[model samples]
Target: KANNTLKEIAEILMASRSVLLFTHINMDGDTLGSSVALCIALRKLGKQAHILIEDDVAAFLRFLDKGYCTYDNHIIENPDICLCIDCGDVDRFRERKEKFFEGKQKGCIDHHVTTEPFADFNFIDPTASATGEIIYELLKELPVEVDKDIASAIFAAITTDTGNFQYSNTTKRTHLIAAELWDYGVDYNEISVELYQNNRLEKLLLQTKILEQITVFAGGEAAICGVTQEMLEETEGRMEETEGMVETLRDISGIELAIFVKEVSREKCKVSMRSKKYINVAEISQKLNGGGHARAAGCTVMKSYEDTKQEMMRLAEEYLKG
Candidate 1:
């Protein structure tokens, strides 16, 4: 039933002299945090390790140390292994896919339910609440000290991915791992403040704007909203500020499905979906050529925002009837 060989993966990492970690395009907390922790662990073993993230870290997460997770690979010249952390699809590499494959070896460690093996070696554990848990296990196999920095990174990854142990994917094992990481002196209090309490006023206004004009349909079982370029310009908000806005829609009473669309361009829109009770948003996303977990999923639609919104409403109506 296990989809990974932790010992074998550990051996592969140990043998490598230089390691490069690749995070996904959007650069979520799970990918960035997991990669940072793993990179630190590799370095503690006296090997050269660096994290490669093509996109800029969001303003909220910029407080994290940049030396471990960097925008450029200035130190890593020729990596012995390139590992993708919390990256489900090759598309996540975006412009950096070539750098990922350039290493002598490649591997993937992920927790997304839709992910499959796409590297030379893969440890795909959908049961894990976050890839950080897998990295924690792998670190236990390596001969390195679990210092405060590593613990803080892993804690951030697990907490964010699990919604601070609020999401359905969180398991008993998650709490146990978190408890153990606490022993290593993780600065969890600071992480919580950065993640939840440090929202900018512009972001607050933008979220308020989204909720004020949400569209309800399918007999009020579904709610939808959008972030247009015009809206961002008006509120002085960035696209990354809209990360958790869809969850607010799902939290509304009587809402079973929530959809948030962000205008990518004049003829393209990005869609994020979240379901509270029974609807499988992942199924809907796959139908639209995207994939994710049951409760959460996303897709990119090649159509005008209005057209994409209408299509999502139609799908929500159809799915709500079940």
Candidate 2:
């Protein structure tokens, strides 16, 4: 029944005169690839379609051609549909939410459990590993065939989100989809190198600096670390370099939780929390206005790192104690 609903969504889109797709801020590969795949698919269906590119440059995804996706307001010359994918809520739309939805038809496809599904037509599957996975399923529902480009894009989306099939979210279904993409001639090794191994040397230096700041709390039961713009500048690394460093702290023999507080700017801090066992970082992240999977989640903090770190630890400690 759920898959039927997503098929209805594809059918509705196929009939639309025009459509625009958007994803969360600081677009990652999964969001970018999924948005692009949907845009390409919609266009192939003989509809005017385009992907809205975020103004913020996601360092990890900088290798993608900037011009591949269009971000012009002129595409909305005629009132049509707007599609939001991977993103959970309107807030994740950043500055363009108002313009994207204002006086325009709305549709959504997402895989976030916390998503409120704010679209005229919505298809959300929280169990899916990534939005790209849902997109692949939707394409299967469509009578149209999946081409090489569409296959590659969806493959990129799922691979990145599942950490190249390393994360716990990677299920047998994910592997099956991966096998199909491989049959479609997707180069898994090249994509992995470009997406994950292309980090700059500065990011490595920053990782060293960050590792030096690792703090083990309550006898290694909890760990915390932070990075500032100044620290990033000193290491000549962009904020993206801090990607999986926090999880490294979780590697400690007895640490159950690892927290990384990154100062995105003067007042905004990007807080990423991860746990291995019983600690529910999701609950702690929600208290700070963030959301993600049970083991991994994040929120943005508008306060100083000191205050934010303290409050997060305080809230997290409660879970640890319980």
The model with the greatest TM-score is 1
TM-score of each: 0.95, 0.92
Alpha carbon lDDT of residue 229, candidate 2?
A: 84
> What digit string (tens of lDDT, one per residue) describes model 1 on residues 161-203?
8888998989999999999998999877898999878888999
Where does candidate 2 stray beyond 4 Å? 1-4, 63-66
RMSD of 2: 2.2
Leading candidate by lDDT: 1
What stretches of model 1 exceed 4 Å from their correct place? 73-78
How does each model score on lDDT? 0.87, 0.78
For candidate 1, the 10 contiguous residues with the lowest summed lDDT are: 69-78
Task: Give candidates' CA RMSD values in order.
Answer: 1.7, 2.2
Candidate 2 has what TM-score? 0.92
